[model samples]
Target: SRPPSEEGHSVDELCPNVRIHEGVNVSNIMEVPFVVSIQRRISPNLFAHFCGGALIRPHWVISAKHCFQQQRSIDSYRIVGGTIDSEDTKAESSEIADILYPDEQSGSHDIALLRLKSPLTIAQREDFQQLKLASDVAANKYHSCHCFAAGWGVDSLDSGQPMRYLKRARLSMKFPKKCYEEHLYHTGNFPLYEDPSLYHCFERGEGEDRGVTMEGDSGSPVYCHVTDGTGRVDAVLYGPVSFGYYPEDANGVTIMADKMTYTSNPQIHADWIRKNMKQ
Candidate 1:
C-alpha cells in the first residue's frame, strides 16, 4: 500500500489500483560508469541509500541541491561507485568532504557538487567513468537528442523501497512550450524556476519496456549520447533529476504521466560547476 497523502486521503482512496514492479536493471556496471549512490549514515556501521549522483571528476560529484537540504553535515553522507548494485559490498566508497552550491542570489538551480574526502582512482578502471557537462549548444538541441536516465531509486511508487541494483530508462525530450503547458495544467502551478531554459523536460518513451524514476531517485544523472571530437560514441551530462509530477487517474490511482520528469539544466550552471570543481 502507498503512504497517505498530506491531504488526509487514505492510501486506498488515493491509489486504489496502485501497481508495483521492479525497474529494468542495468546488466553491466560499465554501462553507467558515472552513476553513484548517495547514502546517509543510519548507524555506526550501516548506511542507507538516499539519493543519486554522477561522478564529474575524480574527486567531484554532481547532484541535486534538495538532497542535502535537510542534512548539511558533510560527515553524514558518503558515495558509492564502481558498481551497479547498490548493495554490492565490494563497491568503492568515499566520505563526502564538502558540498558546494551556486549563489542563490543569481538564480535557483537544483544542482550541487560534492567534493570527496579523497580522489577515486578513475584511470584504468573499467567500472569508473567521469562525465563531462554538456555545452550550451548541445543542451539547446536536446529536443532532437537521444537521452536516458539511470539511478537506484525505488522501482515503483507504492513500494517506497530503493532498488538493490541500478536501472536505466529511455526518455524523450519534450518541447519547452508543451512541457510547461502540460505541467501547469496537471499540477496547477508553474515550474520551480520561471525560466524554462533552466531545466530540461523529458517523458518516458512509449511501450511496456519504458521506466520512470520514483522515490529516492533525485540527483540521478540524465545523459545524452553524442559523438565526441574523435568520432567515438560518448555521452555528456545534461542535468540531474530535480522533480516529477504524478497525476491521479479516473480511479484516483496515481499514474506516472508523460512530460513529468524535470531535470536541472547543467548548462545554466556549467560556469559555476567548473569554477567550484577547480577549488
Candidate 2:
C-alpha cells in the first residue's frame, strides 16, 4: 500500500490539491500517442507509476523536473508508452539512459528530458508518435484555444489512488495574468513565483465540461490545436502540468472554486531543448 499524506489522505491523493475532475477515460491508445508513463523501479521486476510524460523523440521524453526531487540512480527510472493503461505490464518500456535539465535555472521552469537507453521504433508503431513543441507564435496564441491533457492522475480526494487506465480532459486556457490575479485574490498571496510569463494557466469548464490536473499528473503534456493560414490543423505541445493553487477559506480549509492549474512554458526553453538534444 502507498503511504499517506500529512492530511491522512494517500500520498497520491492530492499533491498540490488538483485533479482531472469529470475527465473521460481514453478509449484508444492512438488518441494519445505521445503520452508515456514515467515509472520508478521498486524492485527487480516491479515498477510503480511516478508521473506522466510526453515522447518528443523516439529516444527522448519530456517531464517535470520536480518529479525527480530526491536524488536517485538514473537506472531506477523508465518510460512506458503505447498503451492507455498505465499498469499494463505488457506495454513497451525503455530504460532511461540519461536526464537533462536547462543550463540556466530560473527556479521557475519545471521541465526536464529523459533519454532512453534505446530508441523505440516509433515510426513503425501505429500507437506511438512524437509530439512537436509549440512554436513561439502558437504558444503566444494559446490563451484563445481549447486544449486537451491526459494522464493517469487521481480523479478525486475520495479516491486516493491514480486511475488504472488513462483519462483525458478538455481544458480552456487562461491568461497567466488573470491566473495570478485570481490566485492572489483568493489565497491572499502569490504563487511560488510572481512572474506570470513563466507559467501557463488553465481552468476547468462548467457542468459537463469540467476537468483539472491532479496529483501524479506532474509532467503530463497539455496540447492545443493550431490552424495555420493554409487551414491545416496541428496539435502542438504547450507545456507540462507543473503546479496549481488551492485557495483556502477563512478557516484555512481548501475551497474548490477557482481550481487553476499551471504548466511551465516549453517555448521559453525551446532553444535549450534543441541545444541539449544534440548533446
Candidate 3:
C-alpha cells in the first residue's frame, strides 16, 4: 500500500524492490564467457521476439539501432548464436547472413550489424567471446563497467511471462550528460541533450525501484572489461529499454516500474561499420 510513486521514493532513491515471486525464469549465466541472444522468427503468427547481441567476429554480429529499424529486409532475421539457452544451444540454427541499420535518424547513432551465413564452427570455442570496439570513448564521465544482458525479458514487471532461460543483469555506468540530466529531462520527446554521438548511460533505481532495460532487451550490448594492455571490448553498442522517471502517482499504490535505464549508441554505427561490415 505504498504506491503514490512509492511515497515519493526517498529510500536512497530505490532500485531493488524485488517482487519476482516466480513463473518465468531465465538465468543460467554459464559463468560469463560471452553473451549472445537475438531471436526473431517473425512468422507463423508472430511470437518470437528477443534482442541482445554481441560476438564481434567469427562472421560478426552487434546489435541495437532500434534492433533493425522495424524489419522488412534482412530476410526478416532468424539469428540465435551461442549460449543463452534456447535449449542448451550447441548452435540451434538461426543462420542469418546480412542486416545493417542506421541510415540517419541518429538517436546517438543507434547500431546494427549482423552477418553470419557460415563461419562459426571453431568447435564452439568455449561459447564465444569476441568484442572489441572502444574508439577512445570520451564525453562526460563515469565508468565502472561489467555489462552482460541476455534477454527474454520480464522476470518481474508483474510477470508477463516469457523468460525461458537466458537472463543476466549487472549494469552500472552512467554518462551522456548524466543521461540528459537524469532521464532525458522527463522525455520532452526528442533532441536529448544536443546529440553527443556515441551515447552512454547505465544507472539503476533512483526513485521508486529503478534500473531498467527489459522486454527482449532491445539490441543489447553495453559492455565493459578492458585491462589497458589489450583486454578487449570496452564500449560500443547501446540503448534498448528506454523508459523510466516516475515522478510519482498516488492512491492504492501501483508503481509497476520506476526510472533509470537507457542505451543506444553503437559508436554512431562507426561510419556504418566501415561502410557495411565484412571485415
Candidate 4:
C-alpha cells in the first residue's frame, strides 16, 4: 500500500520500504567490506529490494530481526556484499538459507542471524571480510573514538526510493539513560530501558551537519573503532539499527528524522549471539 502521495498500489507489491540520512556516498569496496545489502526478489519482472546487513562470517550475516517482519520466504532474499553497488552483477551475492530469531515474538531480542545457503566466495578478493562482533568491554574501549554505519538507504526525507549508491555516516554514541529519556520507547513487553542488553546509538553532530537512520537502514551495523589484541586499530560491530523517530512538518508530512538510540545491544547478548553465530 502506497502513501497518499502515491497514485495507486498493486496486490503483490514488489517494492521495499527502507537508509542512512545525511550520509556520504561510497564507491571503493575495500573501505567497507563488512557492509552488506539485503534484497528481496518479488516476481519475475519485479525489482529486487535493497535492505541493509553486515557480513559477520563466511556463511552468516547479522541483521535486525524486525527486518524479516515482512516474513518473505528465506529464499527470496539475496545477500549482496563486496561492492556497494546493487546492480553490479560482478559483486558477491549469496543465498539466504534461513533466518534465526532468538525470540519469535520479537520482544526485547531484535537481532537475528542470516544463515547463508552457501559460504561466501572470499578467495583472493580482499573486498569481502568478516566483521568482528564487539563485547561490552570492547564497546567501552572505543567510547570516544570515531564510529561509523553504512547502507543503501533512502536518498531524502521525501521519498521511499533507495539511494542505490552505498552510503556511510559517522555517528556519536548516546548514553543508555539519556537515550531512554529522549525516546521514551521503553514500554510493555518491549521496555528498552529495563533490559541493559538492548541499547541505542544516534548521530549527534551539531548545527546543519546532523544525520539519522531512515526507513531502509534497518539491520545495518554500528561500527566502533577498537584496538585489537596486537594494538592495531580495528573496526567491530556494535549493534544493529533497530528503530528511530520520524518528525513531521507543519503540513503533517515527515521532515528530517531523528532519535536512533534503539538497537539490538550486541554487548548484552554476546552469549546468545555467539552460540547462534554459525547455526
Model 4: per-residue lDDT, tens digit, 1-279? 322212233211212111123446676766677788888886853345456877877777889888888867777788887777876777777878888877534347778888887766652365554566665345433322446777877877579887877777766777766776555543424545454446665754432324566778889887765542333455668788887766455797755645354567776666766887634
Q: What is the lDDT of candidate 1?
A: 0.75
TM-score of each: 0.82, 0.81, 0.31, 0.77
Residue by residue across 167-230, what tens digits does model 2's lDDT show? 8877778777887787677566846666777788887744454577788888999876554323
Q: How close is candidate 3 to the true structure, as a TM-score?
A: 0.31
List, in order, the clash count of every candidate structure. Answer: 0, 2, 12, 6
* Residue pairs in candidate 2 whose N, alpha carbon or C atoms collide under 3 angstroms: 18-214, 19-212
- In order, candidate lDDTs are 0.75, 0.75, 0.52, 0.66
Candidate 2 ranges beyond 4 A from true positions: 1-23, 105-107, 123-129, 136-144, 183-190, 206-209, 229-231, 248-257
Worst 10 residues of 2 by lDDT: 11-20
What digit string (tens of lDDT, one per residue) describes model 1 on residues 148-167?
78998886667889988888
Report the lDDT tens digits of candidate 3 across residue range 159-225.
Answer: 7655656655545566577777665556665555357444666654232222455666666565654
Local lDDT at 157 for model 1:
64
Query: If candidate 1 were superposed on the true structure by all CA atoms, what would the RMSD be?
Result: 10.8
User: Pairs clashing in candidate 1?
Assistant: none
Model 4 residue 52 lDDT score: 82
Ordered list by TM-score, greatest first = 1, 2, 4, 3
